[model samples]
Structures are given as C-alpha cells and as structure tokens.
Target: MASRFTRLTTVVPQLARGYAAPAKTVKVPVTLFGLNGRYATALYSAAARQNALDAVEKDLKALDALVVKDKGVQAFLENPTINRKVKLDGINALLSKAGKPSEVTKNLFETLSENGRLDQTTKVISSFAELMSAHRNELSLVITSTKELDKATLNKIAESLQKSGLSEGKKLLVSNKVKADILGGLLVEIGDKSIDLTVSTRLAKLNKLVTDSI
Candidate 1:
C-alpha cells in the first residue's frame, strides 16, 4: 500500500497521467472532465488496480452518508475559511473514527488536502460513485414529485419502471425527491434521460403553444 501510494504521489506531478481511463471496456465509460472528474477517475483507476474497488466503494459510501447526515461534517468539507492543515487533520480523525477506510481512500483524502481541493470533496465522492455505478452496470432511477413518496408508492413506481424495461438488464436503484415547485405530476430521471411531466412544464408548453397560435 505504501509503495502504491508513493507511485500515485510521484505520478500526480505529471498532471496528465492519472486522468486516463482504464484500458478496458467494462470500466467506467463516461468521460470525466475537470478537476473533480480527474480526481474521481484517478481514484477509480487506483482502486481497480489494487483490487480494492469494493472496499473503497463501501468506505466512500459510508463517508458520503456521514456528509449527508451531519451538517457539521458537510460544512467542514465545504468550509472555505478552514485552513488546509486544520481540515486535513479533522478529516483524518473523522475517517479514523468511522469504519475502516481503505488506503486508497485515505490517500485520496491526503491528496485533496495537499492540493487544497478539499472543498470539492463532496463532488469527488459523488463522481466516484457515478463511476462505480457505471462499472457495476447499475441504473439510477430518480422520481421527483411535489410530496415525499410513501414506501408503497415508491415500490409501485419501481415495479412499474421494472416492467417497462427501464432497467435494461442493469440493477435498478430507485430514489424519490420532493420538489414542491413542480406543483403536481411526476418528473422521472433515468441515467442521462429525463421525462418531465410536471404541471409547471405542461402549463408552460400550453402557454407557449397558445401564444404561438395567436
């Protein structure tokens, strides 16, 4: 692990080395750009190379949960006022207290801190998860409605989506989000595709059509 970390650190100074996608079709297919994307891609490649992908995924998911569940932690990651050394110390302590974090994950935290990229930690985690999902051939289904969905409603929506072949042989992961501004109806997003049936969108279309016809 130390050797691998050394290699990563040595390679990072080259700037263009770690951003390359793995030379396999089954790896993450999406082209990630920008600093967050490059960091996520590098992490994905390193985890894959070390055969610690599953452990890294679990570690990241756990940390992601902490970020979501604790506002203080989220603020700590996003806090621009915090100095790099202070933030790095806090993050190392947090990860040590949490479940076992893989060497790859720990190295990633260190790299982010060393480069003053801690503010983008949340985005990096999210992008890494996206890469993981693609590698696992998982499909994400997000339903947006005016109100929070009950379990039964969510189940029904999942069942309906499954029957409609939305999964496409990939595992289906469903989530619901509430957006009161939509007023009514559902807005469904599957991967890169979105179906917007919200009342607001329909009303806007109607208004546009009526004005155009006039």
Candidate 2:
C-alpha cells in the first residue's frame, strides 16, 4: 500500500487528466512532509490546475462533517477488513447521494480508495486544508495557555507577532487552546515555528540541570 501510494503521488496529474485543465505544473504554496502531505500536495496541484480548489475544499468539508456525524461511515473507512472495491463502491454511492461533487473531488476519493488508503481520508483532507490555507497566504497561529485567553489578549499577541515579522506579510489566523498542564505562561505556535514559554517546560529544564549537577 505504501509503495502504491508513493507511485500514485507522482501520477496524480495523470489520474486527474480528464477532470483537470491542460497539463501544466502547479507549484504548491508550502512543502509538507510525510505520505499524507504528498497526497495533499498532489491533490492541491490537481485541483489548482482544474481551477476547482474552492469546490474541492467545500466537498471535503462536507465529507468531514459527514464522517464526524456518522460513526458508521467512520468505522467503514477504518475497517481494513472491508474489501477495497466495496469501499470504493460505497464511497461513490455516498458521494452521488450527497450531490454532484466536482470531478477533482471525486477523483481524490477514488484514488484514495484504489490505493487502500481509505483509512487516511481524514488526514488527507486536513492536509489539503492546510495547503489551501497556505495558498490563501493565511498563517495559522496557535496560542496555548493554562486557561482560555480573552480575545483582546489573542489580538494583542497576533499584532505583536505581525510587528515582529512572524506573519511574513500573510494574514494571521489566531486561535487559543487551553491546556491546564502548562500551569502558567503561554506556548505560541506560528506557522512551523513554536516558542515555548510554559512554566512546565521551565521547571522540567531546571530539574534536568539540577540532576546533571548531582
């Protein structure tokens, strides 16, 4: 399956030939790592060539919602015991009932099914979303604190980051996540870089230093 996925990644343009526009290279906005990243990048390139990025994204969002709401669908995807052909048929039927999704969207699912990667549907969708976000020049900023931070604080942090050149001329999408284990301080993740200022991390470092001395 891994080898098949690798091969599929290179030939994605061929798979999307019927649906996508004339053969032309479409560069991805950001470089993602791993198998899912490769799949997502291929999908993005295909969608971009087809001029159906928004449509494909909408279809994937709806599919994501459906998977979250329907445990049966979720279980079916993760069940490796199910035949790939059966899964492919089931997915096609589901997509048909869900309305006419763009050909590029359908091709994505078909490729996943054929490659025995039905289980990776969710991850692929997420990675595709990340590509879309990057395509739109949106930088994701995650702020983790011991408790929920107010909007004012979040905005201030985002503004500060922008001034500090962390935004790199991109729009900032700020989100706050609460992690009580942090005890105090904040952990900021902007794009691929992270700044750890959590009390827990400081204490751990101190403990390690003391142990080394002892």
lDDT of 1 by residue, 48-142 (tens): 76677898888778777778889899888788899988997887777777777887787787778767788888899899888888887888999
Worst 10 residues of 2 by lDDT: 1-10
lDDT of each: 0.77, 0.85
Q: What are the clashing pairs of model 1?
A: none
- For model 1, the stretches where C-alpha displacement exceeds 4 angstroms are 1-26, 163-166
Candidate 1 TM-score over all chains jointly: 0.79
Candidate with the greatest TM-score versus the true structure = 2
Worst 10 residues of 1 by lDDT: 1-10
Q: Candidate 2: which pairs clash?
A: none
Q: Write the per-residue lDDT of candidate 2 for residues 2-91, one digit (tens) a residue.
A: 236555455485448575346677889998888888888888888888888998898888888888888899899899999988987877
Model 1: number of backbone collisions: 0
